[model samples]
Target chain A: MFAEVLTIGDELLTGHTVDSNSAFIASKLTEQGYWVRRITTVGDDVEEIKAVVGEILARKPEVLVISGGLGPTHDDVTMLAVAEALGRKLVLCEKCLERIKAFYEKLYSEGYIDDPSLNEGRKKMAYLPEGAEPLENTGGAAPGAFIEHKGVKIFVLPGMPREMKAMLEKEVLPRLGRRKFLQRKFLAEITDESKLAPILREALERFNVRIHSSPKGFGKYIGLIIFAEDEGELEKTVEYLESRGIRLEEA
Target chain B: MFAEVLTIGDELLTGHTVDSNSAFIASKLTEQGYWVRRITTVGDDVEEIKAVVGEILARKPEVLVISGGLGPTHDDVTMLAVAEALGRKLVLCEKCLERIKAFYEKLYSEGYIDDPSLNEGRKKMAYLPEGAEPLENTGGAAPGAFIEHKGVKIFVLPGMPREMKAMLEKEVLPRLGRRKFLQRKFLAEITDESKLAPILREALERFNVRIHSSPKGFGKYIGLIIFAEDEGELEKTVEYLESRGIRLEEA
Candidate 1:
């Protein structure tokens, strides 16, 4: 399966927050045998979010994971954007409202909140685009959401790392079981990668494995991250490279 | 000016590499007064790279910063993709060849390489898309390239953090120059942000400063990142929030 991740936040766009959400989703999706084709990030602008949703949807990834902007803030506009993009009406999810109320009630009990009342902004978290199912946010107030648009599974998760992680494990993971990736890493101590290029190119054409090389300064070492699902073929490639005087550190 | 960043590498998409390159470029662009519109990342696929290049170019961001995939390996396909997208030919530049030769010669003198001869793979780095200028790499072998397309300045830098940073500072920054961004961060300890909602909406409406609020799990605190180019507007917004029982920490 192919997947795409759209992360929304000005914090992420401005570098106030490094987008660990996309990486986390990508890694998780990769483990489930879903090739995360592209990861797109935009600021907390409804129009940009809506436009990206349209674009990524056109690309037609089987699964789409969107993180951030599901907060009580004015900047949180993912729901509105998704609604507009999917031509769905923004409606209140009663279950989500109950969850938000319970969250505030717990805060009230713990003396974290002055009142258990759900104010307008807090209540807004309960609103989801039409036909959206509220995914429980065990770690926070705003409930995460999931919707199916044109056969694409769209998951809207919170921006908070803690909350996003918990919900992803509970809600998204089971939907995508698991597919292990077998990658063989190698660090070749080479004086010049140019010397090994012929071997690298030949190996790439000859084997099922895909080879990637990162040049270390002074041509002393080239870090190679090689990917091959077939263990036997990978071993043969390793042996072949080693036989050609490429000192490979099978990491 | 509008800006966008594209960081290319399979390592990045597959989660083996965390894309710090986009964030670094985004931050730099933000500081230079460019509204970094969006950041898109793609794996080391030629078609993917070409498609994104076409899309982002059509978006017409005045400045587009591209990092990664400029390596001596077979996976290094960004150059080829860019050339094809722009209808440019891949041609070897003599100047780039001289630099490559010098780099290898220095390595040979230092006894880092067994041979100083520039193989076909090493020479391949000199073959840039037509009309592309080599941005001298102070740290590595592959020279970074720069091209101007339809008034958009496209900077292609190496993926290695060290090389990308060096070239960005030396080659790309001067072209962009600098633009200052004025921002104010505040921590508002509040029982309910919903209570402050009216004030925040009012503040957002009345002031030129763009207000962004981040909900801290409980209704205990809300982190705010506000942006204002006008000094007076920033002060007015700050004062108005303080007057409304919003305990503000000028972070």
Candidate 2:
């Protein structure tokens, strides 16, 4: 299966924040046996988000995970943009409204916020695209979204790492089925960096595994990662490479 | 002016590596007054790289920065893919071959590598797309390439952070003339996060500034970043936000 990731935020485009969230999402998706083909990052404008969502849907990936721009600020226009891009209208979910109200009241009671009533910006968090299931946020006020549009599973998550990680674990992972892919990292002790290329090429033609290699340094070791659907295939590939006189140790 | 960053590597797609290089390039481009519109990450496959490169060129960005896959491994096919995408041929740079020869001999002298001979894989690093200028790699062996195609300045650099940063600062930045953009961060003391939306909207209409706000926590302060072309406009926007009763402290 193939997947795509879209991360949205002005801070990302401005380089004020490094996008570690996309890598976290991609790693989790890869573990679930989905080959994440692309990861795209854009700013918090409606037009930009809509255009990107449209382009991604045209690619027709099986799973699309989108993170960031789900807060209650003026720049948090991801939900609206996603709705418009899918040709759906933003409809208020009553249950999400109740949850957001409770979240704010709890904060106000703890003397963290000044007001408990839901203002315009707070109320905006309760709306999602039509026919979307609201994904609960355990650590924050804004709820995530899960929608299936034209056979693509789209998930919109919060920007905060804490909320995003919790929702992805409890809500997102459960929806995606349970097929796992195994990947192993190794350090190949090859003094001549260029000499391992032909051996790697031969191993790829013989094994049903995906291999990636990079020079760790000018030293005797290079980094190698082999990915396979099962442990047996992974072991076979490793054995084949070792038999070719390229010493490899688990890294 | 607008720019785009495309980072190519299989490790990034597998979530084994985080893409800090894109952010570094974005921050530098933003400082040079170019809005980095998007950042894309893909694997090392030739077809995938060619497809993505074609798409980015179709967008016609003023500048495009591509990093990674410029090594002596079998998987480092980025140069070939880029050449094919642009409908050009990979031509050998004689000076680059001489430089590569010296580099390997030095490594052999230092006992870093077993062979000093110019093998096929090592010799592959000397080829660049026809009609492109070679950018020196101060930290590594593979020389970068710079090409101007259809009004877009395309820069191809190595994936190693040390090499990429040195090339970008020395070679890439000098070619891009200096016209700076200013950005300032602040902690706006607003207990109700939603209430600051209208004030930010008003500030945007009154001043030529871009503002991004995020909730720091449920506490009194919220994070704000204001971007402008000049210092006077940035200061005016800050003063206006302060006058609207949002206490802002430089952060």
Candidate 3:
């Protein structure tokens, strides 16, 4: 399946933030056999966000994952943009409100804040899409939301790495666990590409592999990847490469 | 100005490669007042490359930067993809071939390789899109290519970070020196969002600044960013916030 990652924040565009969240999410999705076609980073401008979202949706990717803008402030426009793109309505989720209230009460009891600020923090996380499923936030105040529209699954996640990771692992993974996947990789120590050209061409002919060669400090390394339905076909391909003196490393 | 980044490699999609090239390019582009609206990462698939290139052209971004697949092996299909996307033909550049031959001859004279794969390496990098301008590669074997199509400039660089960075710094930055940019950032001490809400809101209204709060650690720290066309306006905004006891620390 193909996916697109949208990382929302002005800090990302300004060079103040590194945007580790996209890399993290892309890595996880790729391991599960999802092809991340594009990663778009935009500031908090609603028009820009809406425009990019509309463009990505037109591409008809299987999934669109967005990270950022789930905060209590003005720059938190991610939900608003998603709603605008999908033509949904924004509403206060009562269950999310209750959870936020409980979290605030715990913070109050622990002397982390006064009652006034606690209430505001709780209210900050109460907003959600009208019919979206609010994924419980065990790591932070803002709960993530998941919704489906036009055959594309949209996951709106917090910008914080810890919070996004927890929700993705606990809530998102289970929902996508049924998708079958095959992971294959090849490693070669040859530095010169010309020397390995004939071998790579032969391997490509015999196996359904997409090869990548990266030049490292010591030598150039090549990676060959393939996806198969059954373990038998996967093994046979691995054996074929092994007979040709290519190392099929475990991914 | 607007730009789009294209990172090409199967390893990037397969989780074996983390695309630092896009982030680095994005940072540089943003610094130069060029907004990087979309970044596409594709495998070595020629069709996918062509599709993304078409999409990028449709967006009419002022600049298009692509990295990877400039190697000599069978899997390196960037030249072919670029030719297909721009409706051009791939032909060997005689100047690039001569340079590569000279580089390899130097390496061989130094006893780097008795039976050098110099011709193969040169052949891999010599091909270019018809009428494309060559960007000098001071660091590696693969020289970058630059082409202008329908008023949109397309830059193709090798995937290796060292080569890409060198070309960006030496070639891209000089060409982008004509644009003016204003970026102002403030770092504030960690505080709860609720407690700082009133101050932040007042600061935003009083100075017309945009604030983004991100929780940092046990004590939450916030980052405020303001963008403007005039440097004097940005300074005045910063001064106004500081005068209001917002404790602005320049970042």
Candidate 4:
């Protein structure tokens, strides 16, 4: 299956925040044998988000994972954008409200908070799209939501990396079980990438592999990746490279 | 000015590579007072690249920064896709050839290597669009290229973070100078973010501020960021908060 990640936040665009959520989601989706086709980061603008979502959906990716803008703030407009993109309506989820209220009551009883802000933060999590499944969030006040529209599953997650990760692991992964796929990575300690062209070409000719070479730190080391759909084919390609004395390392 | 970043590579899509180039470009663009509207990462597939480029151009961003797929591998199809997107022809550049050859000669004179792979690598860097200007790479074998198409200035930098960063700072930044912008960050030591909502809303009401309350480890503290376009307004808002006995720590 193919997927695309949409990270929404103006802070990311203004350099006030670094987008670690996309990287984290990409890694997890890849580990689960899903091809994360594209990642798009947009500001909190509704028009921009809608435009990007439309473009991504046109590409026909099976899954669309979105992170950020799920807080109790003015800039948190991800839910509205998602509803607009999917041609749906925003509705206050009763279950989500109950969960949020329960969380606030627990926090108040534990003396963590004593003011009305607890209910305010909890209320923020209650707004979601119609016919959405609220994912349990153990890390923060915002509960994630998942909605499937026109064969594309969209997951709306929090911008916080820890909370996004926790929800993905606990809620998203179970729904998307294992699939048949292959991924191989090679780490080479070569100083020059120019010298590896012929070897790379030869490897590609022998196997149906997508090869990517990325140099790091003045060409101190280069990361070579080989992706394929068949596991045996991937192994054979790695073995062929090993025979040519090109060291193969796993990521 | 507004900008968009396009990173092309299968390794990025398959999770074999973590794209650091977009983050680096975003930070640089932000520092230069340019709003990075979106950062789109896609595979090396030509159709995917074409689609993203088309959408980005349609949005009419002032600048479009592209990284990755500049290598000599089979999956290195960014140049072709870019050419197709701009309706331009891929042509070998004479100056780029001289630069690449000179780079190889320098390496050879320094007793690095006398292999023919150097020439191949240089030839790879010499290929450019018909009217594109080649950006020199003092760090690696791949030289970047710059093209202005339909009012959107597109820069093609190597996927490697170091090379992309060096080229962006040395070439891209000086061309696109600085702009006046206001950025304010406050670190609140409160374990509960609920206590800060009212004050945050108050700060926003006083100034055009977007506050991001990022809770850190075990709810120890919430890092607050208030970014605006007016420095005086931000200062007034901060002073108001401080005067109200709301402890504001400079970030």
- The best candidate in terms of lDDT: 2
Task: Please say which candidate is ahead in lDDT: 1 or 4.
Answer: 1
Pairs in clash, predicted candidate 2: none
Q: Which residue pairs collide in model 1, if any?
A: B32-B179
Q: Is candidate 2 or candidate 3 better by DockQ?
A: 2
Residue A9 displacement in candidate 4 (angstroms): 1.9
The TM-score, computed over Cα atoms with residue i paired to residue i, of candidate 3 is: 0.89
Alpha-carbon RMSD of each model: 2.5, 1.5, 2.9, 3.2
Q: Candidate 3: which docking quality band? A: acceptable
Sorted on TM-score, best first, the list reads 2, 1, 3, 4
lDDT winner, 1 or 3: 1
> Cα miss at B178, model 4 (Å)?
3.2
TM-score of each: 0.92, 0.97, 0.89, 0.88
Best to worst by lDDT, what's the order? Answer: 2, 1, 4, 3
Docking quality class, candidate 4: acceptable
**What RMSD value applies to candidate 1?**
2.5
Cα lDDT tens digits for candidate 1, B1-251: 68899999887777777788788888777777777889999988899999999999999989999998877667788898999988899999899899989998888788878888888778888889899989999987789899998999999998888889999888998988567456778899886667777788889888888787876656578888777777788889899989887889987
Q: Comparing 1 and 3 by DockQ, which wins?
A: 1
Query: In candidate 4, what are the lDDT values of residues B87-136, reduced to their tens digit?
Result: 88889888877766776677767766554344465476678877898888
What i-RMS does every model get? 2.2, 1.0, 3.2, 3.3
Q: Which stretches of candidate 3 lie over 4 Å from their true place?
A: A114-124, A189-191, A218-221, A245-251, B106-114, B118-122, B194-213, B218-220, B243-245
User: What TM-score does chain A reach in every model?
Assistant: 0.89, 0.96, 0.87, 0.90
TM-score, model 4 to reference: 0.88
